[model samples]
Target chain A: MMDVKDRYIIDTIIEKCEGVRDPALIILQNVQEILGYVGKEYLEYVSEKSGYPLVELYGIITFYPQFKLNPPGKNTIKVCQGTACHVRGSDRILGTLEELLKISPGETTENRLFSLESVRCLGCCGLAPTIMINKKTYGRVKPSNLKNILAEYEEVDQYVVE
Target chain B: MMKPRVAFFDFASCEGCQLQVINLEESILDLIDAVDIVSFRETMKEHSDEYDIAFIEGSIVRPMDEERLKKIRSNAKFLIALGDCACTGGVNKLRNLLPVDEVVEKAYGDVYDNKYFEVEPAKAIDEVVDVDFYIRGCPIRKDQLLYYVNRFATTPPHKNLDMRFDVVPKEGEVDARSIIQYNPKKCILCRRCHVVCNEVLNVHTIGISQKGNRSIISTPFGVGLEGNKCIFCGQCLVSCPVGAFSEKSDVNKVSAMLKDPSNFVVFVVDPIAITSFIETLPGSDRDMGAEIGKIITALKEMNAKRVMDFTPYTYLSYAAQGEYIRDNRTMTFSSWCPSVQEYLEKFYPEYQRYTHPETSPANFLLKTIKSKYPEENLKIVLVSPCIAYKTSDAFDGVLTSRELSALFKSNEIDLDLYSCKKVDFDKDIEMERTYIRGVRSDYSYARLILEIAYMSKFHNLDVTLNVTPIEDYVYEFAFDSEEGFFSALLIEDMSKLRKYLSKGIEKYNLVEFYPCLHGCISGGGQVLTNSLETIDKRIAMLKEYKGVTDLKNDFISQVIKAYSQLKEVI
Candidate 1:
């Protein structure tokens, strides 16, 4: 298990509070930024910092897809499921990605480098079944080539690290 | 010389296509000079009892249209099916998938005398009468009308002409069960895939061979299209009206590209062989050379193509295998078409049949360009109308006409400004028009297929052909199966809905699915409405201004000479 950083968490909290008024919104954004998910640890951290009750922080974070507090993977793959994307066979892409990565939505790989997530109607429905990895977009992706897609990035990431 | 007497007739339609016809005001002047307009009810009150050419619009749904078409056919020397409704039964054909009586009842069961005039099944003009030529599109392109009128007027009568096409019907009817999996029931064989393949893509992979009731479009030797070389581009999905051909879409990839920036993006525009981009783009009768140049410029400006058209030598490796299969007297399959490859990879994996497939014009051009530049930074985006191209996974991104429309919509491609620019055909080099066109002619897979087919037949080799072009099969099978490979993006809740619906169920809502019905036209960011006539006029404009310029370039000529030499040697 990776140890959490306090300064990094404080920095994210400060970033959220810049213009936002709703305490729940700040905490939700804060939890997602800190732990990559809204988990128990994030709720505890929010209660201590903002003087908001743990129950209150948990209530907001769990409700929205934007908030996350768990120890998410180092690389998150968020796939869009919208009407345009759906007809274009975006479902199989998600399945193919899941099979290739060996992780379902909300789960991280053992290496902690990959986390799979699903998003709704990313406003680019024309492109349909769109996938995002670490915030980078890949359009018109098909299931037949899912392995190669993940492999390309992983290979590049490894090369960069080495 | 007496001009041909022509009349325009409308059926159950919005009369939009007719309006588009009238919108060709300048071209209409040219048309009026050429033809004797006997009865154009839309523009003139002058009635004609006789006509040589009857341009029919709309689908035959009402009892009146069926009789009206017969009278028009009887009076006219030739009947030209104009617009999609006149060709493929268009939007009204969607109702064909349902019970005609039920549909009519839903619209007007209680209001009027339902017993007096029952709604007939919607059908194209060809279904009702002998149609001489078909000008397809939702609204028929003015240029195509000009092309047909000019050509037909000059040519001698069909009886006097040396025609080889046998009009007689065939003996055996197609086992409807074999093709009709989802059983839409009203599967009028529009064979838009056949036209898209042969006319547009030039991939002689799908076509209607046998006549009448036996007429069916299939692969070369009529084998199941599991996996051949047909890259899924999804053009056929948009072209067909009654769901005769369609595939599960990959809209998710579109979402991904928008979200990601690190990925290099390049879209491949199918040269004239596959689709007339000029016609598909917004506006009518503009200089194609300039318009195409502008589009290429726009794309290049967007940093879409880091590489020019690059040929994949590996496809040659695959095509060589196909040639070898012929040489070795073994059954050979073409691997050049993406749909063919996908069919093999998905359904017919047993035919792990490797063919030394030649590079497509798209891959040839883009790969060469990408290799020359930043190969690492190269993310090839293929802007094609074909659905099979979507499945290739070769280019970094695959966009259909619908998808490109959405992309253009996103950037707000000012078509008015695009059209207004004085097209300089000379400076088209900026868009790499010559280079792309040169590569396309040198590497057209259909031309290659025709050459191969000719040689195969000439030699009388053991060739049993089952050639369903990628464009056709992708359309035919897309959105037909559960766990179908076409699934791209679906939320958990929607995914659950998809799971509950049967493949046969009209799960696709017309109101919602209407935009995507034509695929890219409905793409969220499309620049213009999907109008076939508009695109066609653009195509004519492109041809007039460009005028074999693509072939004239030294680079293209050299490539043509090289390919010609290769053709002679091979």
Candidate 2:
């Protein structure tokens, strides 16, 4: 059973999907955007409304990397692991973050505040060894500077709440 | 034309289809004489890469498999997919439900890292390489294989592969296992099995889990049927179009039993199964009785010690139902249909108390036989159109109508060749006049209930019975009586059954749920024919048989005694 908000979001997404080609993909993307992730219930609801088998919908969901089945954390830390980043010792920086956050890449922290990910490229090659936390990018970040950078987000959380 | 050099190749599979080629019996000599068997892993030790025609079995599940299949494609002039795995990706595709890495890890354990081949999602041979033709079935049908081999022998090498042959569309595997096997490769994602299991039967034992090309019809959460609510009804097997859903065959075991001189094999065939068997060999001059006689003769020729019709037990079941109703079990659900009983036991346990406690007709007859002939080493081989009976422990072996046909055809014993003669049962069983010949329609059991009600003096009976084709799946039987107006509904297909149940069926006192639309006659084990006219014709033939007989004075007392004993046991 889905909550009222999730149901409304799905209903709205389904309505927007009307008259569109490949409504299944469209509806799925919309639901993921509104809810931060696509769950089985939403997929089943969409399947029921769209008249598509849930198995086909699941196939589409798993095939594409863009679709997430789990909710994202409040803050996402994306470390560039592209060719340029690798040359600049991004692996050391990634190791440092994983140790500090106590979570592997593609996993969320226990506090639900941060998610760590090592992406192919952030497309910011000029700033090699770069790590971005919720739109704020730190260029040429070293392993030693990781704690200070993480502390800034914790401070920001208190400041915003206060 | 140098006997088109033939080779057999396998990927991820059980190689049962390849084994079928070996199991061709006497016709195997003809196949050997016609085609040069260059390579066969199961039967022959020698191998050859240079082959004009290649018969590939199993699904492509690894990168190496794709590369090998491509090589085979380049090497061979024609590539034919053998069995459900090679043709449709069969049971191998079940792993597609999970991540390849996860599946590998779970299967290989700590040694997964050292594995040579990288596991990928299983796909039909056609997905990776070009396939000229397909021999469909979990294990390819031997007769169909023989027919194709004969065609390949006469025809040119590079003919357009799409040329359809008059191949007999037989029912899939009829291996008498306790569980129904769902072959993922042959599954077309039709969801008919899921629909039938969840909706029509209300068993909810199987559903489509996982998404996309990886989706498989399985018990919820990938659990085996043993722990699940699956009643072993095998409605899913009948609904599946391909070899995706089928029962394991016990043909080898039955054959072995027949050959053993020490064994006395009793072939007990259901009357309805006789109709289905006759239907398979279309355009036969033999009527219902003639077909039965011919089948008995054929079995006898195969060394069956005693051949009997299942009508005696059918009468017993009818009598039991009558006795149950007379006992005033407020609302009685017929337990004759194993699937319906399974549905009540698994889904509607509240109604379990109301169900008749009598064992199935097959079980009763087998039990009676064993008890009466305790000294003999008796093996009961139940021949029926119903796949559900395959799971029952009462019979030593179960063969479907299609299987019976295949066995006969493979053995070169043509039913049409034999002249119909009057065949008598080993023992004369007495039946009462109260017996009614069961029809192939869905309302037949419901009619029995109504008859029982009438016989019990439930006056002013207003009965409404609905019977339709398999696709329609709507069979509702309701009756109004002066003594509290007992009403019952029988639903044929799953989708309608699901819809009907969703609305709540508290109004009806009794309900008969069938997985197949027209009861056991249209069972999964029957020959594959979707034509309504053909089915109707078969039903008409079933109606022609007078299975019921006048009861002896002692038979009534026996039924009463059995009912009393059954009540105490329950």
On TM-score, the leading prediction is 2
Candidate 2: segments with Cα more than 4 A from true spot: A1-162, B1-178, B188-221, B224-231, B282-286, B357-359, B409-412, B426-428, B432-443, B453-487, B493-509, B547-570
- All candidates' chain B TM-scores are 0.37, 0.59
lDDT per residue as tens, model 2, A1-162: 588888887888888778888788888888888888777677778776777655456656766767766567788899999999999999999998888877898788776788888889888899998999989899988988888888877745432211
**Model 1, TM vs. native:** 0.32
lDDT of each: 0.52, 0.72
lDDT of 2 at B256: 82
- Residue-by-residue lDDT tens digits, candidate 1, B248-327: 33345554564456656655454332134444455554554455556666655554533222232322322343244334
Q: What's the count of clashing pairs in each model shown?
A: 126, 18
